[model samples]
Target: MPKIDVNKVAEILKKNELEPTLLRRVMDELRLAVQPDPGEEEKPPPIKKQFVILVSDPEQKLPKDDFVGWVLQIPEEDNVGTTPERVCRAAYDFNDTKKGSLLPVSTIGETLENVPAKHFKEYNTWVKTRTPVLVVRTDNQIPKEVVETEHF
Candidate 1:
């Protein structure tokens, strides 16, 4: 088989009036096409799970600057019911041990609600209608304020 000369091909393309930008783009595409497929061993990073807890203050007891929401990082394999129970227990223990006024885990459990899976707009709407919401989500789904603000 005759060896194809890259310089000769470029010269022919130039002589035929092909634009330099178009040639470059075509070359880039061909180069991409020739790349080896990613190996199975080179797996993508695992998605981290998070819990978004939106606590509402119906009695307006908390300070104005305090956030009502919290984003808690959890293990990717944690049980759905267990993590929230653990959170509630921690909140209860903190209140009981430190002489705080936070609600009991049983009470919080009663108010536990699920956010809609329809994403931001639906979540916003659901939040507007409820108090003390709990939802399991991936890291990407957490709201910016929940992670940045003081929600304790």
Candidate 2:
């Protein structure tokens, strides 16, 4: 990934065309997590449900983090079974980019919870121990986070 820079962060926000206010909050959090000054109290990276999405598919026999994985967390839910689908979908969608990326939803244990248990079966978690990965196989244009969370 590019070196941590406010300029890069701003560029990302601009390129993605995100809301300035929300992007600012997320950027501030990223700074705290990725660019904490030394000797300052090291805080636990913001923990909600950060996903370590591997850019390379596991089946492709690629090394870990070989491409461009994104580390993100699921937002809090107001009710049970209401995990932050935005972050989940974001990470899951990223993981689904390649059949070999993570478990392709066709291979994960059926009893596992939190992981994508919808249509398709070959998918599973990249890590043997990971659960709730939210992987998907859809190739259609990605939907907006709001739509994904609500209608997905």
Candidate 3:
């Protein structure tokens, strides 16, 4: 392979209207995209899309009839109030017309069996705040003011 000068590449990118910082980022991404073994086939990048709704617990100020299901991060049994906190999603039976449904408290390890470890890690990070749970509303249940047609 021919040795290419990084500064020259940056200059060419700048001439083509890409900013230096953007050029660096693009180069970094290219480095990450390169496969180590030349014989290996390139794979498509994983699609990163999710419908995450942030809301307080349904038992609180929010009206109970609005949501379909809730997302929760069940903390570890022994490490209740600690940092680098781990989490798992608790199941909810939406069909049960019961008010104030129970949220199970299983260890984070249990979720690994169901959810991919990569995604669970992201969910765990998202739910670290005081109200980490996500209330997934039904298709038409979200308030009109919060809905934007352009983003959908």
Give the runs in model 1 whose Cα sits over 4 Å from its true position.
Answer: 1-70, 101-152
Model 2 agreement with the true structure over 1-152: per-residue lDDT tens digits: 65667778779788999988998898888777776578888678885754544342435455433333222222234342333333344345545666326543332232233344331132321223334443323234555665535552
lDDT of candidate 1 at residue 63, scale 0 to 100? 59
Task: Report the error of model 3 at residue 139, Å.
Answer: 12
Order candidates by lDDT, high to low: 1, 3, 2
TM-score of each: 0.22, 0.22, 0.19
Q: What does candidate 1's lDDT look like per residue over 25-95, in tens digits? A: 76676566656687636768899754455445556555555334434334556554564555454444445
lDDT of 2 at 11: 90
Instruction: Provide the overall lDDT of each model, using Cα atoms, as 2-decimal numbers.
Output: 0.48, 0.46, 0.47
Candidate 1 versus the native: TM-score?
Answer: 0.22
Error of 2 at 119 (Å): 57
lDDT of 1: 0.48
In TM-score terms, candidate 3 sits at 0.19
Positional deviation of residue 85's Cα in model 2 after best superposition, in angstroms: 68
lDDT of 1 at 28: 70
What lDDT does model 3 reach? 0.47
